[model samples]
Target chain A: MNMIEAAAVHVRFGDRVVLESVDLAVAEGEFHGVMGPNGAGKTTFFNVLTGRVKPNRGRVLLAGEDVTGLSPHRIAAKGIARSFQIMTLFDEFSALDNVMMGLPEFRARSHDVARAAAGDSRFAAKSSEALAAVGLADKGDIRAKDLSYGDRRALEIAVALAQAPRVLCLDEPTSGLGSDGVQRLAALIARLKGRLTIVAIEHDMEFLFSLADRISVIHWGQVVARGTPHELQQNEWVRRSNLGKFA
Target chain B: MAAPLLVLDDVRKVYTRGRVIRRPTFTLQANLSLDEPDIVGVVGPNGAGKTTLFEMMTGSNAPTSGRVLVAGTDIHGVKYRERDRLAIHYHQSYQVRRFRKRIPSAFLAPSPTRTPLVHLFDEPQFNLQDGYIGFMLDFFRKLRDEGRLVVLCMHPTAAWHLDILAEIAGRFLFVAGGGVTAVANFGALVADPRCRSYLGPEMTKAADAICHGAVHSST
Candidate 1:
């Protein structure tokens, strides 16, 4: 069964439709990549998954359970963790603290635990491990406000990883990174393969090509093509669309 | 020729917590000449003292030794109120609680005496949801066109915003361990041979520094 399934979903704002009859499914432990131009409804799709937007029509299923109108927090509780295109780190908080905030249902699950225990040596170890996984292990204590841009992006990924979710969604993970930085992120994603299901929206074709197991092209709020990276690379229609430039 | 935009001479800082003395006297002497717009990238390892250098440069923390001059004027010599009036520091983890709120008009407020140089410690890592990233990119561009110098201190992960940084600032500075190892125009910096070599090392350091503060114990 698919981990996440969106069937014939439609989303509109006033007279404009952002997503029209879009159908997509994420298999267990699959690394899915969504590629498109601006206004192609990539972010709108994320909104639908997180229940930030109620689809005008159609249904969303998580692990075979219908969740079309569930709240974002509820969806998150159900093992979905998303990192924004632009980072949402807590500036005043330390990097470790930011990752702690991303822990799944920690508030309720660890309520009985004392504050000192919450900030215990073990928790710190886990946070450090997450930081190191994203190549930010050394920056655990620096305030979010003090990091450089590339490091901040890595921290965002670290926060998502901290959730230990079954599904991970990343928006434009390589949007502003230089070539080397993009390569590092791709390497990190590659390492996480098979352990988690990933759905990423990205514009950088090079990085996506290297990291994505499957590619879905979105345009005019619809799924124009879906295939393995090589298949999508050869599709005639994809060749004619925005994917051509990247090709 | 047009007066150094920012100058630092033998700047030193010491962190002493009781008996534990960490780098009691770290020094950096640099002459930064910014006659036009520039984007400087400060790169360093965690505990390499990147933030400490920024603090001393921006006057957020006083240096144990040496002088910092901005626009041919000694920043340390100026009164705190006057310095505050002349500088704007945007730290990382800068949050935008409201998406609808307009960009602070104070950012665009006129400065008749000298061109305002904005310091963004980690502006890109802040809340960038709801088109705010585009808004900030455009805003910084305008500041650059007006001849303002914008300095951004970024960790390796936040390095993706360099495109926006390049569009806004013409020059760049890469600081590591309370010192600048590389300085150039945004274009030149990207193409610089030294930038690639030093970027990874400096980023690792910055990340280490952040981790040190967050975990508060050995990894």
Candidate 2:
């Protein structure tokens, strides 16, 4: 069964139509990539998938159940976790603490973050495992603000991983990273590819072309083109452009 | 019989300066009927009211006079939220414009069709670097094949851009000097004096080459 599906999702912000009948289906363990020019509503589509924005029409199905219009927290609770384009991390807390906060077990015990941070052993172990998955196991004790940029990006993923999510939605994961950082991030994502389902909206075509099982080219608030990297590169213009280097 | 796909009946839009004096700054007029499903390319210079024409066709901007009919339904009379169901206007990446909702949607009728009969793409970015042109061109053809009229408006800055319009569009509309002229084919479009002036020297030469079979498109 498809793990996550957006069925004809339509979102309009007042007079401007942002997403016009967008349909996307990600099979289990599929690493789907979304690419588009700016202002083409890529982020808005992500918002719809993660329940940040409610669709004016159509439905979002998670494993065949209608979950459209669910609250963000509710959607996250149902095993769909996301990392934002803008990093959201606790600056003063240790990387371990940041990941622990996202743990459902830790949150279930208490809303008192300070008390929960000191009272957990199993949660801490799970947090450490999550950090290790993102290659930040040794950086667990370091303050989030003290970590390097690349480490911070991995730490954000670690935070989502701690939730044991079925699907991970990443928005512009390689935006601020340098070439080396991107390479390391790619290696990390490669390790997790088959184990987790991922839908990433990325501008770096080389990264997506190398990693994604399939790519959807979004334009005019719709999926204009979609195919594997090889299929998309078959165009005459694509063979001549810099994107051809990936081919 | 089913109604014509799209009809612009004596449409006119005038933008006036000075609310008190109301002196007209610009005026655009178009009266055309496209009765079949096909790709129609629209080309013109900047500020030639092409965007205005598209907005009016999609029912976002109400024509100063006359009507825009999509499958015989008056698009402007349809509810604002439902207008896209009859005719959707896909704006250029940078060209985001909003028009006032003068009448409340409560008073307007719902869209007559579930899917749009007319699809207008305004200056879709055809970047060579992205190489999505082939897919996009195929999509336009797919829409036409499904029996929907496709209106593609583009400013052909490069020769390849003109090649795309020639290879894809069956007919052409040249918007200039506050009027719309329908050119029967790529051959006629390059030969028209106004279109030649709009295309300028370099592009006109390239277009002529395409018309004369000297330039072969790689598509």
Tell me, by lDDT, which candidate is best.
2
Docking quality category of candidate 2 according to DockQ thresholds? medium
Q: List ranges where model 2 is wrong by over 4 Å.
A: B16-25, B92-100, B216-219
The local distance difference test score of model 1 is 0.66
lDDT of 1 at B13: 66
Every candidate's chain B TM-score: 0.63, 0.96
Residues B54-86 of candidate 2 have per-residue lDDT tens digits of 989999899999999999999999999889999
Q: Give lDDT per model, in order.
A: 0.66, 0.90
Q: Model 2: per-residue lDDT, tens digit, A40-131?
A: 89999999989999999889988888889999989999989999999999999999999999997788788999888887788999999999
Q: Judge candidate 2 at residue A180 and give its lDDT.
A: 94
**Predicted candidate 1 versus true structure: per-residue lDDT over A220-247, tens digit per residue:** 5667567787776564333433444555
iRMS per model in Å: 16.1, 2.4
After TM-score superposition, what is the CA distance of residue B6 in candidate 2 from its true location, in Å? Answer: 1.0
